[model samples]
Target: MSEATANDFASLDAGQLAALRRRAILSCAIGNFFELFDFTIYGYFAVAITRAFYPSGSMYGTYAAFGAAFLMRPVGAIVLGAYGDRMGRRAALVITIGLMAGATGAVGLIPTYRAIGYWAPILLVLCRLLQGFSTGGEWGGAAAFLVEYAPPGKRGLTGSWQQFSTQIGAVTGSVSAALLASSLSEAAFYAWGWRIPFLCGFLLGPIGYYLRNKVAETPAFERAVETRTVEHAPLRVAMREYGTRMIQAFGLSIIGCIANFIFVVYLVSYAINTMHLPSSAAFSCAVASGLVVVVLTPFVGALTDRVGRRPLILACALLNLVFDYPLFLLAIRGNTFKSLLIALICNAVFQALYTGTIPSILAEMFPTRVRYTALSVSYGFAVVLFGGFAPLISTWLVDVTGNPFAPAFYVMTGGALSAIAIISMKEYRDAPLE
Candidate 1:
């Protein structure tokens, strides 16, 4: 393949290239799907995990442990992101899936605090950190893979698959949690039932590794290597040369990441614990919102190719700023299953518009040589700073201010920041990748 050269890719007929793109998409999508599934199941099962790991039974300890994972993300972004830029995207993706899945499986097997004392929470936090580290690399690597493989006019559609897989993973995780929570007795669920999803996620790791290994290296990365343009030190180059671009990606990521965690991941918990809604109903509603993202994101992604990335993403950011507070009020005051579902779905629609285009935007911001490291670092820091601790911070906001609508303020802050980024960004929808 080293001798094959960029001309080899150029020589491929349309049918051959199309087939190759599909394989690339499937291979890249699988790892992200599994990664998100495993990560999300932990969030969905936080209540059970809190009961098992925290002796005091206060969710603060569990939330801290959850937030601890985010702290490792930027480190992973710098480390694994550089690895991907240097070694290869495929190599880094394979390693991330193994580490992520292995840690997830370990979480399933950990003994509760009653059985293991303080060691239980220690073990749980360790596993979460490992998951976070792997996830930091997985998303950027996968996005780079897909967008690099994408044909000129179809980058948005191809890149959307990254977020599409993510939504599917969340859907599956929500469904798994909903099923287990609904079917098991409360005592049983708190005991062994919650481990089932984690273990199942573990079982799929090897399969993802195998599929990724079978796929070819992306044409863009291969060309960079062939041209001797691959950066030996991508992280340094990115920091020195692309600081402004990195900031743009970071700012753009803020609202989407926060909204995803707050509305999609945390809302279930908020519904159950704060609003006192039924667990089954909350998870089911999450599934509905996730489905909306899964179904709508691709179409919205395709739309961006026609309408321009700036318009849709800017609209999403502005709308999120305008509507999140009222929606939170609707859910908080009404406090019904239907009301919560409606609010979540509305958030999901806005979320889809941004997420669908972000993969392409991030990928387009930098050249193939330093793309992985730069994109990963920017996105990872944004998530760690704004999104990763969303649940904990939102909880604290409510606790301190005595307002259940407090989380909306957090989401609105992201929207405002991201709107500035979107407004400042150059429209890259029709631009070629560097």
Candidate 2:
């Protein structure tokens, strides 16, 4: 037989292919869940954490410190992402999981301001940097791992699990924090109740590690190794060959990041600071929104496989631009549980359209040899520019303008940018998984 004919015959049958794809998705999703769980625990417990480390006289200082921690994320992504492309996805996954777990657990044990003075905030920043580093490398490796193993026609469906897992983690963190906070007095909650969620990371880590280790290397990576197709300098190759794609990825990411910050992070702060809602009520609404996102994400992923990334992304962006101001007004004016829940659900469902398919779309833009590095570097930079700084900028904008609608304008601008980016990209639905 000809070499091409032999290669064609080596492909798995339908049943075997289904089984392999399931295993790959589950393995990577489990690890991704814990990584997000650890990272998001901070946001969920931010009020308690800020109270523990920063004085009540300066809420701005407390948030500023949190923003500083977020800034470390891009650096972590670049260093760890390059390592994943150079070495292998499996090794990178293992290291990231370990670092995330260890750093999270250490946060639980760190001394508070009363105990350690200025060192408390310093140590908090150090732990956040470690968490940032682990998360930076985690998404690209995990998403690439799943997509590289997926069937060509269904990579979007398989890769969507990564995005779905993030919302799952958010829900998990929220519920855990709510339960813990409910069980304690306000003094106790501020004193030590916040640490329990971070401690839970230790238990989550081993389960993720076991699942990730059980999955075999992806067929794409195996083939690349066998044929010596691995790039000697994946970063250099990505910058030279795929620079435009990187810019597109960044532009596309703006809406997702802004949506998350506005709906998830700043929403909580707004509820507490502006609307004068109870912390529990605000967090409960967030948990409900997360559940909505989790339910909608997989379906959107399947839809993207059928309709293509451009239409879904563009639709979401345009809808966001139209609806953002109204939604924020509804949320800020009503100040009731029902109104909050309605706004949260709408935001989560719309955001899922972009978030669900992004992993597959970004991964498809590059070949297997440099896919992890390319996606990670682009995503990290976007997060730093759009996601990490979003809450701080929006807060400052609102303060400066003395208008709650200032944040609405910010959201509209991000959505507009994303719409432009999505329309500019080539239709990647028919692209090969490699």
Leading candidate by TM-score: 1
Whole-model lDDT values for every prediction? 0.90, 0.81
- Looking at model 1, residue 273 earns an lDDT score of 80
Cα-based lDDT at residue 159, candidate 2: 83
lDDT of 2: 0.81
- Candidate 2: clashing pairs of residues: none
Q: TM-scores, in order shown?
A: 0.98, 0.94
Per-residue lDDT over 1-434 for candidate 1, one digit per residue giving the tens place of the 0 to 100 score: 37475667889999998898899899889878998898878888888898999978777887788788888888888999999998889999999999989999999999999998999999999999999999899889988999999988989989999999988998999999999999999899989999999999999988899999998888888888888888989999998999999999999889998988888767778888878998889999999999999999899889988988888888888888999999999988999999999999999999999889989989989999999999999999999998889988988898899988889989999999999998988988877776
Worst window of 10 by summed lDDT in candidate 2: 1-10
**CA lDDT, candidate 2, residue 341:** 76
Off by over 4 Å in 2: 1-14
Look at candidate 2 and tell me the lDDT of residue 268. Answer: 75
